[model samples]
Target: MPDRILVPVDGSPLSKRALEVACDEYGTAEITALHVIDPTEPGYSIFGVEYDPSTAPRHGSEAWYERATELADELFEELDALADEHGVSIRTETVVGRPDREIISYATDEDVDQIIVGSHGRGEESRLLLGSVTEAVAFRAPVRVSLIR
Candidate 1:
């Protein structure tokens, strides 16, 4: 009996799968697609690839933040359109911070009844070793959580 379902998307295949599952499962309920841009992500220091500090967007710059915002907005718009096609009402939100913490906090603060998420995001190895945002939300969320891989 979920009234509100939260789905976190990161422009990944698994996230899209989760979105599909959420829409099917909660056909008449409100669906919210949230994208989190982690400001602490050090895209600069890659062990294997050549690190380019100049290529990395500075978190404090207005241009950097704006670009990130636009990207997230585009992703949400796609999700929103798909949800609309399915006759489901969907809302979009973008937040800045660590993914795990932000997701958990949002679920707790909002009246979200369920969370549908992918078990792993872009960080494959890191997710295997340190767990993922899905795991963090599953353990700490005040509501039910459905993890899609």
Candidate 2:
């Protein structure tokens, strides 16, 4: 088993499953959960919040970042509880950037031995145009990568 494992979380069911696998299978390893906020997709709302241009904060503004941070906090709370259930303690980080790049950079800079990431089953056409984060990380990461779909 890897001594250090990185897990990228996005509050998706597959991401949650990836975390579960990491905690269950690599419980002894040092685990880190990374959440990336893509500034390019400023209109993206993951918490089921309706995106109303009139009411929503301006994209890339301070208020938008604050809202993203708040959402990240909510995600971490749930992840922490899940890790607790598995008797595993994980460090959490939230960064603003593209998910794939951030994940790969973290693994390389932090010297993570392995990465467990979720695959968002995107359709072939969609993937051809914009590859999934899992695909990017798996291809560019220096360490081993395990995918959970």
Candidate 3:
């Protein structure tokens, strides 16, 4: 069994499913939740037409950074609540970088034994069978990758 499982949560239902699976299958192991911020994300603002309303700050602005931090905190809070419900403890981390690279890098740097991630995120790639980020992580991660739909 993996001593630690790293899960990347992006507030998407699929990612949430991944988290749920990690908690269910590895309740005794350490679990870490990671959230990454992509500065170049198109239409990142809450008012943008490309994405759902996030009440997010203007993309690339100072307020955007602040909002990102705030959102990260809230994300962790939600994860903590989920963990509590499952009788598990989850450590959360937030970073500013490409999601795939950050997820793989964290697993490598922290020596995590496995990664449980969603097949897709909150992006347009859902139409694809596998999200680009998830595909990259599965191919590049030094540790084992378990993808949940």
Candidate 4:
């Protein structure tokens, strides 16, 4: 029954599966694909030197940041093509920040009817250490959220 559906994408197989679900269920609905670049991610650190907590590289930094942004744009372009094939209107964005917070904020601001997200199992230890972004979004979003395995 939702008219506008937001599906966050990061080129992961799980996220692609969520996109499949969106295409299947909301073939005629408006879909927005969002890819957020988490600046905190230590994408490339020399000598495996643990990323400094005090001075983490800004999310949108020199070379790596541009690479991430370019990748996000490419992913969205692919999604746009898929949407065109399906005759469904699609919108895509590449934001810089924490993934979950940005996604939730965008959904709230856009008034998206629902969010369909994929869960990337991080094992027990990782989940305990960092928790799950999908879980946090599910719990905090103002609108309906469907967590896809």
TM-score for each prediction?
0.81, 0.90, 0.85, 0.78
lDDT of 2 by residue, 1-149 (tens): 69999999888888899999999999999999999888998555353546676887998889988988888889999999999999999999998888899999999999999999887766655645323778899889999999886
Residue-pair clashes per candidate = 0, 0, 0, 1
Off by more than 4 A, model 4: 44-60, 122-131
Ranking by TM-score: 2, 3, 1, 4
Model 2 ranges off by over 4 Å: 44-49, 123-131
Best by lDDT: 2
lDDT of each: 0.75, 0.86, 0.82, 0.76
State the lDDT of candidate 3 residue by residue for 1-149, as single tens digits.
Answer: 89999999887777778888999999999999988887778433121124434665566888877777777787779889988899999999888888888898999999999999888544565556677889999999998999886
lDDT for predicted candidate 4 compared with the true structure: 0.76
**Pairs that clash in candidate 2:** none
Candidate 4's TM-score reads 0.78
Question: Where does candidate 1 have its weakest 10-residue lDDT segment?
Answer: 42-51
Q: What is the lDDT of residue 110 in candidate 2?
A: 97
Error of 1 at 119 (Å): 1.2
